[model samples]
Target chain A: MADRRYTKTHEWVTVDGKTVTVGITDYAQSQLGDVVFLELPSPGRTLGVRESFGVVESVKAASDLYSPVAGKVSAVNEKLSAKPELVNSDPYGDGWIMKLELTGELPPDLLDEAEYKKVTEAGAH
Target chain B: MVDFGGWELPQQYTSIRNEHLAVRKVAGLFDISHMGRLVVEGPGAEASLQWLMTNDLAPLAPGHAMYTLMCKEDGGAIDDLVVYRESKDRFLVVVNAANRAKDTAWMQEHLAGSATIEDHTKDMSLIAFQGPRAHELLPKGSSKTDDIPYFGFRAGKVAGESALISRTGYTGEDGFELFVDSGGVGEVWDAILAAGKAQGVLPAGLGARDATRLEAALRLYGNDMDETVNPYEAGLGWTVKLGKPDFIGRDALAKVKAEGARRSLVGMRTEPGSIPRHGAAVSHDGHHVGTVTSGTHSFFLGHPIALAMVEGPSFRVGERVTIEVRGREAPADVVKLPFYRGSARSAVAPAKP
Candidate 1:
């Protein structure tokens, strides 16, 4: 969890060496209740930092999933197409949206766990 | 929680999907106290209401109810409401909460010689016990809750509280709406919840309510139609009794009837992955046809459904249409009104759809 970085848009990325895993934070999933569907970029798509890579849809709304770091898409979680509710039930683990292999620089504005928690807490009110 | 017409209410108590399924398979309770409850009584009650409303209440004997609309002189909707004939000289008019003030002023301004109007909205608590299992959950004293026919009300004691149990609901299910004193509402609400908890009855909220009503294709006043929309175009032409001698909007409605609607309300269905939100644009073959009036991801029906006011005489059933969802034109099929039906259809009533 300490390795995870978050964007103001509510997406989180965990970088381990050259490969990074991406998903929405638990706070994001709670705000968008009952995820029903997801649209993820397939392997080989190049994404710049902060670019919209896909979409996450819940019963309440549809939000764009932005990339926190510049990278080339390596894989998308196929588990989501069969069960999107994972985004609501286990947003940080099984709900992980995609994995990317780093190709470009990481966004400097990405927040660490403590910083992201502060951002989400401020929005709760 | 959100403020709905000055009443604080949650969009979903548990979850919209779970609460919606409870109403479909078991039961769900809702606090519908926001709806305006007005009592009109006196010798002229029947005649005055008949003149103001589109439905002729002449044959509406006491103990019966009729769904009708009140319109402006231009035939645009004032409000869609249900009038319950309680007795020969008294009637109860339930109207939309947002239109309470407007409806009251309109009714009073057009008041006739004998009848009087009283707003009981602040004095009464309205609870909807809706679902297929609704009848099984009501308090079992006199067992009168089971006897009230659809749209019919019976004054009785429920959970030891004086109540008027009416077999009616906005959900497309067999249900009873209980009207009780506002001060003692919590007692009755708790009693009903305790009784039905074992059967998966949930305290539902606005989210589930909106979804169920959309599946049934019941029009919401402000969303589906308003002061500028007429009955013929809002898919409620059946509630207009043009045969009646005279009403506030009779002349204009007659003209519309003779000429036919240029744009009419129609139902549209999309796949499971996408939802049609309100105010989304509806298009056909790259041309903007109309706009979505009301829409939701129907948790019970398992498909996203919508009601749109499209250019009529052209948008027929089975025609493929498109809705702009998230900046993309999502494909949808134009279907019949009432994306689904339930036990409420079993009761004898005016034609639906």
Candidate 2:
């Protein structure tokens, strides 16, 4: 099982072995209502922690995608372009945004799924 | 709920997609109390309006309403409003919420008669029940007694409260816009909700409103047209009565119509995956033409659509063009206005195919 963490901006990162999958939290998707378009970063791009990786556009507004862990972008979610609603329907599973190859030690502030749930329940997102 | 023009109005009481589909499939109710209503009454009302508006109001009979453009002397659109002729000497001007105070001040400064201008917005709450089932949901005896027809109105009661129901709406649907006293708004809303509950009436909000209006190609005041754009250029040339005896911006509109405005409103449909957005640059053959004013993924139409005001040499229908989405320019085709028509009564009464 992957260990999950979240950012105040509503991004989530799941560390599975050496790869970290990043995506917007379910709370973010609910607030956005519908995800119409997703602009993803290309695979193999190097990114620092908290760096903006892409943009998610809803019918009403556009929001930036941020990286929770610093590393090289190993893979991008190609399915989002044709069906961005997947981000809304499944924000934590198949809707994962990008897979980053962890370059160094994982940060400590990354909350567990239980902690993420607590943060979300507190209505921070 | 979303903050629209500083008003914390619901985006949808339930779900936007569901509410939108309900309006298309059945009916949807909207709490549009945020819209502003101004009353112009007294003997000088006619002359005062004639000088402030572009439509030929002198011809509008009592109980009639006309969608008009309130413009500056330079012909720039101040706001698009619905002027309801309550009588020869009294009128109801419905302005966009964001422009209410500003519009009132502008009209007050241009007053030419003993007509008293009063802002009835805060005192009155506006609600709209729109869809194919609009008439089916409204209280009995609510539909016009006479041939009020589309774009017309009549004073009547809804849910046992004094109301002014008009056959007007932002959605291109068979609808009624009700004006009721603010204090009784909550009760009226509950009554209508209960009355239409069996018919799948949802309390729609700003999200559903935007989608329906966009599908109809109805120009939003702050987005599609503004003080910098004239009515003629915003695909409202029909509303401009050049022969009107006299009105503000009449000369500027005539000149613009004659010489052709710099840009004209046009509709564009992009490839399935790329949806253009507001402020996105519009282009043709690699040259910037205009900008996208409003764009959305029409859930009913199942495609990404947009409305743009492109410069002269507008692309003909079916002619391919390009619109910059994100950073890359994507292929789009120019099309006639109105991307989708609803199941409204007006649309149901087919106009010779």
- After superposition, candidate 2 runs with Cα above 4 Å error: A1-3, A15-21, A39-54, A67-83, A93-105, A112-125, B139-148, B344-353
Docking class of 2: acceptable
TM-score of each: 0.94, 0.88
Interface RMSD of each: 1.3, 2.2
Q: Top model by lDDT, which number?
A: 1
lDDT of 1 by residue, A8-114 (tens): 89998898889999999999988887787898898999999888998888777889989888889999999999788888788899999999999766778999989
Give the best candidate by TM-score.
1
**How does model 2 score by TM-score?**
0.88
Per-residue lDDT of model 2, residues B1-353, tens digit only:
76777778987675677788788888889999888899999999999998999888998999989999989989999999999999999999999989998899999998787988999988989999888887778754354423447787888888888888788888888778899999987878888888888989889988889999999899999999999999878989888988987888999999999998788899999876577888999878878889999988777677788999888745689988898877888999998778877654463343454
lDDT of 2 by residue, A1-125 (tens): 45567887799888788899898988899888878778888989999888888888877667888888889999998888777888988898888888999999887777777877787789852
Model 1 chain A scores worst on lDDT over the 10 consecutive residues at A103-112
Which candidate number has the best DockQ? 1
Residue-wise C-alpha lDDT for candidate 1, range B168-209, written one tens digit per residue = 899999988888999988998988888889889999999889
lDDT of 2 at B8: 85
